[model samples]
Target: MPQPLIRRAGSADADVLTAVGAETFVETFGHLYPETDLRRYLAEAYALDRTRADLADPAKASWIVEADGEVIGYALAGPCALPHPEVTPDCGELKRIYLRRAWQGGGLGARLFGETMAWLQARGPRTVWLGVWSENHGAQRFYARHGFEKAGEYDFHVGDTVDREYILTRPPVSFSTVTTKTALDEHNLA
Candidate 1:
């Protein structure tokens, strides 16, 4: 069996991403959604054309983890898409990180998340955010272990099901100095 390898995705991996992403989504959350809704959501979210476009988009980055010649997990990062008012304009988002069930609990999630976080940090976003389904305790724990804190909540539409999701955020990296518009505070002092 070939060892697991993590590599950045390219346009050539669109089909692979579509397949793995669809399967992983179904495997993890299929129970919560009707088949038709699931299919529609998959078609829109993991379509080959959409994945290809994302692969080609300069604003986004996706990674694939392959083991034994099969995609076992994947991660994606890009500019913030969630419309949380607390999020800074230029904040980054850890969009998705999905792994096959057989591949979890063996330290792979941490490795994948670490890589994804590094990618987001390199993009120079002081804050990185992700949305997790409120009932997914394991996922919530996983994000918490990575230093993410509950920032806010929002309604996430999952195939017609409006699920409450917790928006978690963490600083990517600490800088030596941070500048704020303390001009207001300074003015108030005067």
Candidate 2:
């Protein structure tokens, strides 16, 4: 396994980042998100140009992980919409944390997640949150292991399927002050 370097992503890396995002999404959720709707969602959410814009946006923070000098994973965090009818104050969200299929299970996911959480922490957001489809048991388990607990429920449209997602959060997680040096015994890369 090659060493994966995690760094702050810039506009120049948008194209590869976008591609990584699409591939990761397809590999991770293709079965959960219908095939027809998958392409549409990927196109809309991860188009190269849109990713470039996002990297430039002050409201969003993104990072990329490279192995063998190739971008294989990326994570994005930013302000997210809360679905609760009862309003709450500001909270940071982990919009996406994706890794190419070949990169999964390598402890790279933990590295990316720790970095993203640290990034959000520096932004002064009180809580770090994200949503995972209820059916994505793997992701749910991952989030749980990282201290994210189910906070609420919401519905979304994926292709033609209406699905439920659990809103999860790590309360008052401060990225600037958090240091996650806890490393797992690496078994295999992906």
Candidate 3:
């Protein structure tokens, strides 16, 4: 396959993002919820208007990965909104990162993550945060490899279902401490 094109997302890409977001979410976790609950969550979370507004927000950034003219993955980052008390306006959060199941485990996710983190730290170093499903051990391991540590726990709602989620944080590091190459090397994606 040719290399997938990864680019910054804009308000114009709302429809595609909505479709990809819902598809990826369902692909990854649909089995964990009932049909009605999953539908409710997708309706609210991937609503086109909500996505468009988010894309238009200057404080947030999103990227989409496309191959053969189809969006296969996406990542979103914005000002910290995790429930941790230590979270401040200056902190950044990895709000969402998803890839179609077939596209995972091929270093694409790491590339997408690297891009998101670079954007988050572009304004200077601040604590970075993300919430991951506690049961998703692979994801937890991936974050840990990238320097994130479990900082707390929280409930993440998907319709009426509540998932035990781990709040992970990467403390501010000087540029010299964690270069882009270092991040990729840690993942063996370089």
Give the best candidate by lDDT. Answer: 3
CA lDDT of each prediction against the hidden true structure: 0.80, 0.78, 0.90
Q: Which stretches of candidate 2 lie over 4 Å from their true place?
A: 85-89, 175-177, 181-190
lDDT of 1 by residue, 40-149 (tens): 88889898888988899888899999998889999988888886997776798989999999988766666677677767766464788999999999999877756789
Question: Worst ten-residue run, lDDT, model 3?
Answer: 177-186
Model 3, range 1-190, lDDT digits (tens) per residue?
7998889998889999999999999999999999998999999999998999899999999899999998999999999999999999899999999999998887888878878888888878889999999999999988898899999999999989999999999998655455665565546853
**What does the lDDT read for residue 176 in candidate 3?**
46
* Model 1 TM: 0.87
Please state the error at residue 165 of candidate 3 in Å: 0.6
Candidate 2, pairs of clashing residues: 121-175
* Model 3 ranges with Cα > 4 A deviation: 174-179
Listing every candidate in turn, what is its Cα RMSD in Å to the true structure after a full C-alpha superposition? Answer: 9.8, 2.9, 1.6
Note the residue pairs that clash in candidate 3.
Answer: none
Error of 1 at 73 (Å): 1.0
Best by TM-score: 3
| Candidate 2, residue 23: how far the Cα is off, in Å | 1.0
lDDT of 2 by residue, 1-190 (tens): 6588999998888888888888887777777766778877777878888998889998898999988888888999887675854325577789988888887886888778878777777857477779888888999988887678998999876656678888988777555445533244223224
